[model samples]
Target: MKFYDFGDIIASDTEFVIFGIPWDYLSSKDNVNSSTAPQKIREVTKDLALTTEMGVEIPSLKVVDIGDVSIDPTNIERNLREIKDFLIAIYNQKKDVIPVMIGGDHFCTFPVVKTISKEFIADDNIGVLIFDAHLDLYDKWDKGVYSHATVSHRIYDLDQFNKNNLLIVGTRDIDIPEMKIANEKGINHFDAFLFSDLGFKNLSKDIVAFFQNSRIKSLYVSIDIDVLDPSIAPGTGYAIPGGLSYRELWQLLRLLAKNFKIIGCDIVEVSPNLDAPNKMTSNLAAKLLIEFISFISN
Candidate 1:
């Protein structure tokens, strides 16, 4: 099924355009299959309640699920080009629509972000906020430069992004090399453990303040499912402890939407194969996507 049974075409009044990236060949783990996430998440949405937790009717949201990008898993360059062109086509239809992406892996975010950033006449006021368990700051990984593990670094390498405008949060699992690179580049990330020390209110404010201080007005958020505690979201490749709770993230996203113009967003790395029999991870992914849409809509 399509996301919330939304239309398959983008119209003039479309506020959000939802699409999927079904390629995961760039993920570091061989056992985990995140490639199935986009479809699985869509399938679960059919069983969800028609209204959001805040009582907003889901059907009223101006969203269209245009379906997944055609991907050849082994062909990385071709997939990147296809994903970029797919987004370009969406903008060709409507420039003001917010693109919501459901992903195969974190690497899927790279192409979408790259394409969206280019659409801006001046990217100086744009910022990127990433929610993940690992820094994903490696310049290269087992599969080389284009791997999922190198996604953040690749984004940072973009001409319009820098330490001030790009922030990574909910990090707990950090490899020595990635940590060293993050430190050397002066990249700032909020570790998961800080939630306990700072509390949710202060932490959320600080996140907003980071971009505000940098004079960032347009924000793009990327969420890796593993950023949540493993007990609650175990369907991701890396199950790290000391992650954010569902409520925490929900409130944070609410605050973010209130504070900045969220131009585009993506939720990635949800490995349905590793989820419980109840399909909790996919359900959570679906919930987060819809709720965020609701927040942005209101």
Candidate 2:
């Protein structure tokens, strides 16, 4: 579905473009029905109003939903290529349009990150802000290099992405191997405990200051729904306890939107099949995206 479906808001150039990738072959976890997340999120967003509580208006924004990318679960290489080519086309066609992607799984982030890093090749100023429970820094998991568990490792290997420019937030689940890699790469991270201790205001201030000091002018945000406490977002494949609260997630996005020029983003791992009948997980995901886009508009 189109993000807003406003018939009268037509223009040659759009400021935001929403799209989906519905292939979940790379997810090691079962119930790979996360491929259905894009449509589920669109459904829950139907009841949303045109403005956020912060008074950021969304109706006036020029945004379009280009639908899901054509992907084949059996063909992993082809899936990645399709995603990369699709985004490259969009950027080439509309330089100002920041793409917001709905993912099939956390692995969906690899291609998007790679594409954005290459898009802004002028400097190493393009940073990544990932809200995920896992470190996702494994070199390979279950004998596969492109699985969801190794997203950060692949991105870190990219020539355009600097190790120091990577920041993982809301992380609590990480294996010793992932931790070793993070330490070796000097990748910065913040867990749920630190977030609660620092509070939203101080944490946001520190994050923005870190980015500014590092000269990170462009950012790509990747949010794994599992970053939220499973009680709040139980539809994800991997559910971790003691995750960030919904309000905390929203506040972090607001701060990032207000402080940085977010070039592209993805919301991943919303497994509709695992959700309760209320579909609260999808509703929360939609609301977060709405607030984020609204903030970007303002």
Candidate 3:
């Protein structure tokens, strides 16, 4: 394995291990530019504040920067195999280790869903909280299957794991046919309009309800950082104009942590090339991940 070695990360009792996957093949801004994401984000985190202002000491959770899995974007099939094997090693471990996955692009989500579904939920289903602006489910792309635009659809691509246990929030940029496709998959999309019409009080209750109603015990959250407004997170290749605010997302995470059992999750589509002073996107992603991990620990 050509993976980075944070020696004894599993044996030394680490709660979270950061895994980087730097390859977004179908990013619309430029072809194959996402190949540099892992390196770029690490460069930016050099000066990132480890603790918050209110003085919640970030836990001594052993964080090892285990680098990206080996893959060539030109060969999608081979890439998928390697990624799955890597995640299987993470999830199927006898000891407890939560993989905090950072991205190359949205397409990276497919291998994650595939591995977790087969490894953990082969007999029982697993639910996911998809926080994104777009409905990410194109039937096909470039006369080939499996692109960033079609990850959500791939979640159900497997025969055993395709149960209606998914709850999608912050979706405001779906095409007419896209909404129909989501409906056909039996997904309950709580659109951004709910935050406007129902208010966060009702919205939070709805989120709690979604998990409570699902038969699945484990929750895997996949956040496309574009779920936040462009003003706050302009570091994504495909960003929508209006999306969730930072504090609102925090509130949602707090609720998720308290209410559900998050098996594993990730944040994808962080493009450092679009960042402003202080690599705002990378810093924000790290802080957010830290908070979510803290919530899970508490």
Model 2 over residues 186-281: C-alpha lDDT tens digits?
888887778778876787787788788888988889999999999999988888899989998888888898888888888999999999899999
CA lDDT, every model vs. true structure? 0.92, 0.84, 0.73
Candidates 1 and 3 compared: the better one by lDDT is 1
Runs in model 3 with CA error above 4 Å?
1-8, 52-54, 91-94, 121-125, 160-163
Error of 1 at 95 (Å): 0.3
Best by lDDT: 1
Error at 171, model 1, angstroms: 0.3
Q: Rank the candidates by lDDT, best first.
A: 1, 2, 3
Summarize candidate 1's per-residue lDDT along 1-298 as a digit string, tens digits.
Answer: 8998999988878999999998789999988888899899999999999999999999999999999999999988899899989998988899888999999899999998898897643656999999999999889888889988999999999988999999999999999999999999999999998888998788888999999999999999999999999999989999988899999999989988999989999999999899999999999999999999999994
Off by over 4 Å in 2: 6-10, 120-123
Mind giving the per-residue lDDT tens digits that candidate 3 earns over 208-228? 777677666677888888889
1 or 3, which is superior by TM-score? Answer: 1
lDDT of 3 at 106: 81
